[model samples]
Target chain A: MPTRNDMLLLTGFVAVVLAAPFLFEPIGAGYPDLLQKFAIFGIFAIGFNILFGLTGYLSFGHAAFLGVGSYTAVWTFKLLSMNPLPAIVLATLFGGLFAALIGFISLRRTGIYFSILTLAFAQMSYNLAYSVLTPITNGETGLQLSQGDPRVLDIAFGRDYGAVLPSSDLFGLEMTGYPGFYFCGAMLIVCFYIALRIFRSPFGMMLRAVKSNQNRMNYTGLNTRPYALTAFIISGMYAGLAGGLLAVTDPLAGAERMQWTASGEVVLMTILGGSGTLLGPVIGAAVIKYFENIFSAFNKSMLGDIFSFLPESLQSGAVSVASLFVGEGWHLTLGAMFVLIVIFLPGGLMEGIRRIGALARRKKPGGGASASTPAE
Target chain B: MASILTVQNVNKRFGGLKALDNVNLEIEAGTVHAIIGPNGAGKSTLLNCFIGRLEPDTGTVIFDGVSLLGIKPHEINQVGVSRVFQTPEVFGNLTLRDNVMIPAFAKRDGSFRINAWKGVKRETDIEAKAMAMLENVGLARKADEIAGQLSRGDKRRLELAMCLVQEPKLLLLDEPTAGMARAETNTTIDLLKKIAETGITMVVIEHDMHVVFSLADRISVLAQGTVIAEDLPERIKGNPKVQEAYLGGAHL
Candidate 1:
C-alpha cells in the first residue's frame, strides 16, 4: 500500500500525463500518433531505468522483451481476439517469463559481461524471429491480422473478418487519434506508479546496494543475485507492456523491434534524461521522440521561414548551418547533446537541473547561512 | 566455554604457494581472539576461509555446530558470522543511515526477502535501531550524509556499525585499523573494546600491535601460512618463534 505522499505523487503524475496532449499542443507535438509513441516509449525507458539506473546493471538486450511482447500481442490478436486487453496481459506474463530465463543465465556475470549476454540473447531472438520463426512471426512482412486469421472472439462479437483489416479497440472505443493516445498515456501512468512503489520499498534499497557494492552486499547478508534478477524481470515485463501497447496502437509486430538499436534507444533516453531520477527517463523519452519525429521533418524551406526575421544573407547562412543540425542531420544535434550531457552533467539532465536550482537559490538576496550548508 | 568457531586441519594452496597449511583453531565463545603476523603470514587467506570467500582444500570449519565450507558468503553472515574488510567495504553510494539500515533489514528478513511493496518509512523499528547504532558509532550527526564522502576514520566506524547492527555471533576484522592515523587507530581500539565487552567473539587480523594488545584477550601468531603460537596476549608476546617470525622484525 502506498502512503499518503505516494498517493499524492501518483495523483499529480496522472494529472500531468492526462494533460500532456493539451500541454504539448503549443509545441507542435500534440498529434495522437506522436503522443502515443511518447507514452509507449516512456514506459520502455522507465522499465529500462529500473534495471540500469537503480541496479546499475546495463542489459543491452531489453529489446528482446519488447519484441517478445509485440509478438505475443500480435499472436493473441490473430488467434484470440482484436480486444487489446487480453493481448497486453499475455504479453506481460510471457515477457516476465522470458526475462526470468534470460536473467537467470545473464546475471551470473557482472559488469560488461552481463551486458554482452543480454545483447547476445536479443540478437539471437531477432534472428530467430526474422528467419526460422517466419511461419509464426511472418518474416519481413511482419505479423498482422490476415484475411484467414482465426480471431475467435472477434468473430463471436459479430465482426466480419472477411472484409477489411480490423482496427484495435477497447470494447467499442476505437484506438486511434485521441482515444488511442489516452489509452497509451494511462498505461504509462500505471507503469510509472509501479516503478514509484518499487523505488520507495526495501527491495529498491537492496537494488541500490547491489549497484553500490555487490561484494559488500553479499557479506551484509543479501543474496544480491535474486534482487538483481527480480529487477531484470520486472524491467523486462515493463518493456513488454510497452511493446504490447505498440502493437495495440499500430496493429503490427516486427522482428526489427528486437534489434540492438532499439535497445540502445531506450538506454539513450534513460541517460539523456537522468537514469536514476524518477521523472528523468520520461522526459528523456519525450525529448528524443520529439527530435526523431518533429525535428527530423525540418527542411531548408522550413528553416528559411524560421530565420526570415534576419537579413536575407544572414538568413541563408543560418538556414544552411541549422539544416546540418536538423532534418536528415538531426543525429548530429543528438550526438552533440549526448556529449555535452556526459561531460557537464554526468548524472544526466537531472543533475544539471539540480545545479541550476542550487545556483538560483544561492543568488537569492534573502538566502543566508542555511543556504550554504550544501545540498545533498 | 564451548567453541564458537572450530577450524580443524584446514589446508589451502594456490599451485605452489600454500595460502593456509593445516591451520587449526578453536575460538572460545565470548572472547576477542586477535591474529597477528608480518606480511605473507596468510592472515587474510585464513580470514577468507571463515567467510567462505575461499574454500580450504581439505578442512572442516564448523560455526555453532553448522558446517560453513559449502555455504556462500552471505549464508555465512546469516548464520551469525560477519567480516569487516581491510579497505572498509561499504555501500558508498547510499547514506550512512541506509548503510546501517541495510544490515539491520538483512538480519530481520534473513538473507533474502521480497519486500518491494512495503515502504522503508514504515519500517520504523528498523530505522530506530539503525539510528541508535549510528549514534553508538559517533556518527549520528553524519547519518544523513552520503557514506562515500566520509573521512577514513568515520568510514571505518560506519563499517563497524554496519557489522554490529547485525549482532553477529563472530565478527571477523581484517586490518580494521589499516590506513588510520595514531589517534584514529586508538579510537578504533576503544570501539572494538566496547564491542568486545558485549561478549561477542571477534577474530581480528591486524599488523598494528597497539590495536591488538589493547583489545585481544587471546592472540594467535601466524607465520608462513601456519599458526606458530596461540596463547594469552602476554604469553604470545614473549614466545621465541613469534618474535623471530613477526614481533622481532617489527622493531618492538
Candidate 2:
C-alpha cells in the first residue's frame, strides 16, 4: 500500500544505510565501533519517536528498557547459547514484558505525573539491577559471559570454546568489527521498515488522535489507553533490540546503560533531529554519536595543529578557548547546537532541510503553489 | 413510538448544591428533543450524566433497555450514543477529513483494534465515507485543511460531521449554535434539519429560542434544577409557568 514517494524514500534510505561505511569515510566515522553505535542508537531513537513523537508521551525512562534488553541478551548468551539471534529475540520479548508492566502502572497518570511515574520506575529498576539483583546482574562489575558457564544450546550444536571466551555469532559469521556492524545495520533497516509501516497505518492514526484529544477519542468510542500502551510496548521492544545488538557487538551489559543521562540522550536525539519525521531520529542519533566519538577524541595537540596558522600568542589563546568546546567538553558543543536548532528551527534539523527544499522549488515557475503547503 | 432514552428519578449534588433534583425525561425514537434552560439550571450537568462523564447520586438512565450508568465514556458511546460538545472537540492537529475518519473507524472497528499492518490509505471505503460526511456539512472543499485553523462555526460543523460519520442511534448536541453570526446560525439550523430528516434521535441543549423552535419536535424547559415545563414547542411558548420561570413573566 506504499505510495510511489514512500517506495522511493525507502529505497533511498536503504541505499544510504548500506553505503554508510564508504559514504562516511570522508567524515572519519567509517570505523566499525562507532558505526555499530550509530545503527544501534538509531534503532533506539526511531522506536522512542514512535511513543514520544506521535503520541506526545515523553518517556524519560526508555534507557531502562535498553538496559533490560542488554541483560537479557547477555543471560541468553551465558545460559542458553552464544547465538545472537536467540539473544536478540529474548531481549526484545523481555523488554516488551517490562514495558507492559511499567506502562500499565505509569499510564494511570498523565502529563507531568506520568513522566515522573516512569522516571520513578526506571530508577527503581536501575537500583535493583545495580545492587540487590547482583546474582543475575553481577553487581558493580556488570553481566558478562564466562567460559565456566553452561551453554546448553551451543554444546548441543557441537560448538566448543575450551578456554577462550566466544563472541556472539550468527551461524559461522562472528559478530565483531565489520561483520557486527553489518548485522546491527541489517536490524536497523528492518526496524526502520516496521516503524515506517506503523506510521502509515490506522493504528498510528489512532495514536496521533490520542495526542490530539483524548476526550474526543474517548467519546468517539476509541479507547486511548490501549493504543498508547501498545505504542509503549512496541517502542520498548525496539530499545531492547538495540540493547541486544550492543551485546552482540561488545558482549557486555552494564548498569550505566540504564542511567537517566542515557535516557535523556535519546530524547535529545529525537528532538534535535525532528521528532515526528521519519528520518529525523536516525539523523539525530548519528549526529550525537558522531559528536560523542569524533569530537570527544579532539586533543590539545590536534587543536594546536588546526590553529597553527595564527600568530603564536593568538594560537595558544584560541586553542585554550576552543579546547573547552571539544574532547571532554564535546557536550558543550552539542548543547549549543541543540539551543541553536531549537531557536532557529523549532521543528528540528528536518525543518531546515524542508525549508531549503521549499526555497529551491519556489524558484521554479509553477512550483510555488506546492512549495507553499504547510509543514505537517 | 418507542422511547430510545429514558431518564428516571436522576439526582446529583455538588457538595450542597443540588445540580439535578429528581430530573426525569424521555426521548422518543426519530424525534429531535431540545432541553432549554437558563444558566445554572443543571442543563450541562444532566447532559454529563447521560454521557458517563458524571455519576448521578441516584438515578437510572436507560438507553435501548440498557443502563447507561457505571460505564466509561467510550462504553457509553459504543452503546450507540455520540455527542458534540458546546465547544467543538475535533482533532485540531489533524485535517478535517481525518477528524471525520476517526469516528468512522471507531464505528467500524469497535472500541479498540490493532490495525497496525494495514495501511490507512488502503481503507478506501472509510475514506469515501469520510469525504461524503464532509460534503454533507459543506466542508468538503476544505477537507484537507487543519481543523485547528478553522473558524468557530466551521469547527462546530466539522465536529458535527465527525459525529455523523459514526451514524449513531442517538446524538447529543450541546449549544450547537452558541456563538455564531445570524447567517452561520441559519446555515447550521438548515444542516441540523437535514440531519434530523435522517430519522436519528437527537437530544439538543440550547438557549437560543429560534434554533430551538426550528429543530425541536418537543421541548423541555428546566429552571432551578427542575423541569418547569414539557410540551410541544407551540404550547410551551404560551405556557405561563415557562415564561415566569424562564423570562420572569415576560410576554412571549
Candidate 3:
C-alpha cells in the first residue's frame, strides 16, 4: 500500500545503501568494519525513533536490550550452531521480552520520571551483567566463542572446525569482511521497510495521537498504554537485532555494551540525523560512527602532514590546536557539531536537507507549483 | 422515550467546599438536554462523574443499564459515551482526516487492536466515512490541513466530526460555543440541530444562554452545587428559583 513516492524513496535508499562501499571509498569509510557498524546502528536508531519520535517517550536504557541481544546471540553461538540465523532470532525475542518487562514498569510514569525509571533499569542491568550475572555474562572477562564449547547443531550436521575458531556464517558463507557488511545491510533494509510500514499504519496514527493528546485518546476510547508499550517492545527488538549483528561481525559480548553511554549514543544519533523523519536516523548513525572510527584515528603527525604547506611556525601551531579536536579528543568536535546542529537545525539533518531543497526549488523557475506540496 | 443516563444521590466534595450536593438527574434518549449554570455551579463536576473523570462520594451513574463508576474513561467511552472538551481537544499534530479516522478505527476495532500491517490509506471505507463526516461539518476542503492550524471554531467543528465518526450512543459537550463569535455559534447550532435529528442522545453544559435556549429540549438550572429547577426549556425560564440562581431576578 505504499504510495509511488514512498516506493521511489525506498528504491533510492536501497541503491545508496548497496553502493555505500563505492560511495564512501574516497572518504576512507569504505572498509567493511565501519560499514557494518553503520548498518547495525542504523537499525538501532530507526527502532529507537519509532518510540521516541512518534510517542515522545524518551527511553534512556535501550542499551539493555542491545546487551541482552548480544548475550543471547553469543549464547546461541556457543550452545547451538555458528549460524547467525538462530542467533539473531533468539536475540530479537529476548530483547523484546526484556523490553516488555521494563516497558511495563517504566511506562507506569511519564515525562522525566519515565526517563529516570528507564535509566535506573538500564544501570541495574549493566551492574548485574558486570558482576552478579557472571555465569551468563562472563563478568569482566567478557563472553567469547571457544573451541571447547558444544555446537550441537553443527555436530549433528557433521561439520567440524578442528583448531581454528569458527566465525558466524549463513549456510556455508562466512559472515565476515564484505559479506558481514552485506548481511547487516540486508537486515537494515528489511528493518527500514518494516519501520516505514509502521509509520504509515493505523498503529502509527495512534502513537502520534498519544503524543498529541492522551486525554483525547482516552476519551476517544483508545488505550494509550498498549500503544506505547508496543512501540517500546518493537524498538527494543530492533536494538537487539543490532546487537546480534554486532555479535555476528565480531563474536564477542561484553558488559560495556549495556552501559548508559551506549544508550546515549543512539539518542544522539537519532537527534543528530532527525528523530521523526525516515532516513534521518540512518544518516545520524553513519555520521556518529564515522566520527568514532575515522576522526579518532587522527594523530599529531597526520595533522602536521595535512598542514605541511604552511610555514614551519604556523604548521606546528596549527597541529597543536587541531590535535585537541581529533584523536582521543574527537568528542569535542562531535559536541560542537551537536550544539551547532541543535541551534541552527533543531529538527536535525533532515531539516537542513529540506531547507536546502526548498532553496533550490525557489531558485528554479516553474518549480514553485510542485514545491508547494505539503510535507508529511 | 426511555432515559439513557440516570444519576442518583451523587455527592462530591473538594475538602470542605462541596462541589456537587446530592445532585440527581435523568436524560432521556434522543433529546438535547442542556445543563445551564453560573460559574462554579458544579455542572462540569457532575458531567465529570458521568464520564469517569471524577467519582462521587455516594452515587450510581447508570448509562444504558451499565454502571459507569469505577471504570476507566475509555471504558466509559467504549460503553457508547463520547465527550468534546471545552477547548476543542483534537489531535493538533495530525491531519483533520487522521483526527476523524482515529475514532472511527477505535469504534470498529474496539479499545485495542494491533492493525499494524495494513496501510491506513487502504482502509477505503473508513476513509470515505471520515471524509463524509468532515464534509457534513463543512470541513471537507481543509481535510489535509493540520488540526492545530485550524481556527477556534473550525477546530470545534473538527472535534465534532471526530466524535460523530464514532457513532456513539451518547455525546457530552462542554461549552460547545464558549469562545465562538455570533456567526460561528449560529453555524454550530445548525450543525447540532442536524445531529440531534439523527436521534443520538446529547448532554450539553453551556454558560451561553442563546445556545442553551435555542437547542435544548429540556433545561436544568444548577446553582452552588444544587439543581434548583428542571423542566421544559420555556417553563424553566419562568421558574422563580431558576431566575434567582441564574439571572439574579432579571427578567428573561
DockQ numbers for every candidate?
Answer: 0.82, 0.89, 0.87
B43-156 per-residue lDDT for model 3 (tens digits): 999998998889999979999999999999989989999988899999999999999999999999988898888999899999999999999999998999999999999999
Model 1 gets an lDDT of 0.91
Candidate 1: stretches off by over 4 Å: A1-5, A157-162, A309-316, A364-376, B247-252
Q: What is the number of backbone collisions in each predicted candidate, taken in the order shown?
A: 0, 0, 0
Docking class of 3: high
Worst 10 residues of 1 chain B by lDDT: B243-252
Candidate order, TM-score descending: 2, 3, 1
lDDT of 1 by residue, B10-115 (tens): 9999999998889999999999999888899898888888888788999999999999997898999999998888999889989998999999999999888989
Question: What are the per-residue Cα lDDT tens digits for candidate 1 across A1-376?
Answer: 7889778978888998889888899999989999999999999999999999999999999999999999999999888888889989999888899999999999999999999999999999999998999998999999887778898888887876457788788887988889999999989998998899889988899999999999999999899999999999999999899999999998899999999999998999999999988889998999999989887998999999999999998999999999999999988888899899989898888888889888887778768545567676
Between candidates 2 and 3, the one scoring higher on DockQ is 2
i-RMS for every candidate: 1.0, 0.7, 0.7
Tens-place lDDT per residue, model 3, A340-361, is: 9999999999999999998887
Q: Could you tell me every candidate's TM-score relative to the true structure? A: 0.96, 0.98, 0.97
Which runs in model 2 stand beyond 4 Å of their true positions?
A: A370-376, B249-252
- Evaluated with DockQ, which candidate comes out highest? 2
Q: How well docked is model 3, in DockQ terms? A: 0.87
Cα miss at A292, model 2 (Å)? 0.7
Best-to-worst lDDT order:
3, 2, 1
